[model samples]
Target chain A: MFGLIGNIKAVPGQRDALLAILLENAGRMPGCLAYVVAEDTADAEGIWITEVWDSAASHKASLSIAAVRDAIDRAKPIIAGFGQFIETRPRGGHGLAAIAPA
Target chain B: MFGLIGNIKAVPGQRDALLAILLENAGRMPGCLAYVVAEDTADAEGIWITEVWDSAASHKASLSIAAVRDAIDRAKPIIAGFGQFIETRPRGGHGLAAIAPA
Candidate 1:
């Protein structure tokens, strides 16, 4: 499975707003095995998004969905930048549907 | 729920060795909701471990389990260092059992 782990840095004091947008759009995409958004404990302006998808294509394709596009547009301003972006090959674990290792 | 995202840096050319130890211990803890290990695309020596648990205490308690402790011992030598460790509070998302927002 395809996986991504990254930190989204919100504009100072805009973390919650960015988080709201993220949570609102969570789990609505096709081929998404998991899409978890969490509040970063140390960095007040940072949020972590951990995702597992069936394939990289599915993840890329979700970008064209209208609601996802809208969320991105809405979040553009408050998004200061992104950091620690890493692409991964998920080999599955508990709470996830069984995924054959790639 | 408790969440953690971090990168484990393995000694040169030992990523797969470290990864083997991690994968061997995956998902056996009682309160662990998810524990996905992945190969970092950008860093040849890096592995990302994304974890979610029922609570922080459960995560801490896991360290005491014989199997977990043994895995840690086996992994210690090949582990060069750690990076980007972040604690998080997970609200909920796809593939996770429903978690009440904390």
Candidate 2:
């Protein structure tokens, strides 16, 4: 499993628009097992995303998709700073035992 | 479960030290099911964290501990913006089926 983690900033009032973009490309993205977008309760302008993909390659490939590209382009103008993507693997938790190997 | 997500910035020269503080309280933090601190591959100074807890109350209580307090206090100077915390529950992927009912 792979992860695509990002720290996003929504424009002064473009929060809804940004969320829509994320929703748009989700599910359709190959290797996407889970996609989560979260808003910081204390700071509405800040947002966090956690995605699980089949591989790092699939995640990179998602960037080239038309819909994904468009959404990212639109978001760029409103964003202040884009952090580098961090990749992660699930470490612990029996709650995720379903993910155990056969 | 609950979540404690944050966007943390380590001082220009204090990344390793900040991580040490987190490591110190990690195992001891009550109700802390998982605590993750990830750095952005593209931005050396940017970081993302995702924490899962037993409950919101337990997460709050963890903050009152001496170790947690020291870590937070040490890291605060390096952090830029402390967003309000947003809690989340795991949603999908059979991988997490282990967390389901007995």
Candidate 3:
């Protein structure tokens, strides 16, 4: 499975607003197996998003979806900057709908 | 929910070995909602482990499990070093067994 783990830095005091948009947009996506949004305990303005998708193509396709695009637009202003973004190949784990074949 | 996202740098050419130990240890842990082990696309020696647990206490308790301790001891040799470790409070997302109360 395709995976992404990244940190998003929200403008000071806008973390909640940014988080709200993210959660609001976290709805039905065809290949999304897991989409977690969390508040970074160390950084007041930081948020972490961990995503697992069936394929890279599916992840890319989700970007074109209206709701996702809208969320991006709405979140742009408060998103101060991005931190480490790591693309990954998820092998398998608990809670995943399906595990990537070896 | 409590969450952890971090990078582990394996000794040169030991990534697969380290990965094997991790996967081997990924078994039934009471409050572990998700435990994903992934290969870092950009760094050959880097691995990412994203974990979501029912609570901070649950996460802490996991460290005492014999299997977990054994995995850590076995992985220590090949684990060259560590990178960013971020603690988080997960809200809700797809694929998680249960959502944290708002």
List model 2 lDDT by residue over A1-102, tens digit each. 565666677778876677666667656777665565655555666666776655678778889989989888888887866544556643222222222221
Off by over 4 Å in 3: A99-102, B99-102
Off by over 4 Å in 1: A98-102, B97-102
Inter-residue clash pairs, candidate 3: none
Q: Name the top DockQ candidate.
A: 3
TM-score of each: 0.87, 0.51, 0.90
lDDT (10s digit) by residue, model 3, range B37-97: 8889889998998888999998888889899899899999999999978899987676675
Scored by lDDT, the top model is 3
Candidate 3 displacement at residue A26 in angstroms: 2.7
Error of 1 at A89 (Å): 2.2
Q: Going through the candidates in order, what fraction of the true interface contacts does each contain?
A: 0.76, 0.11, 0.73
What's the ranking of the predictions by DockQ, best on top?
3, 1, 2
List the DockQ of the predictions in order: 0.68, 0.14, 0.69
Residue B89 in candidate 2 has what lDDT?
47
lDDT of 1 at B40: 86
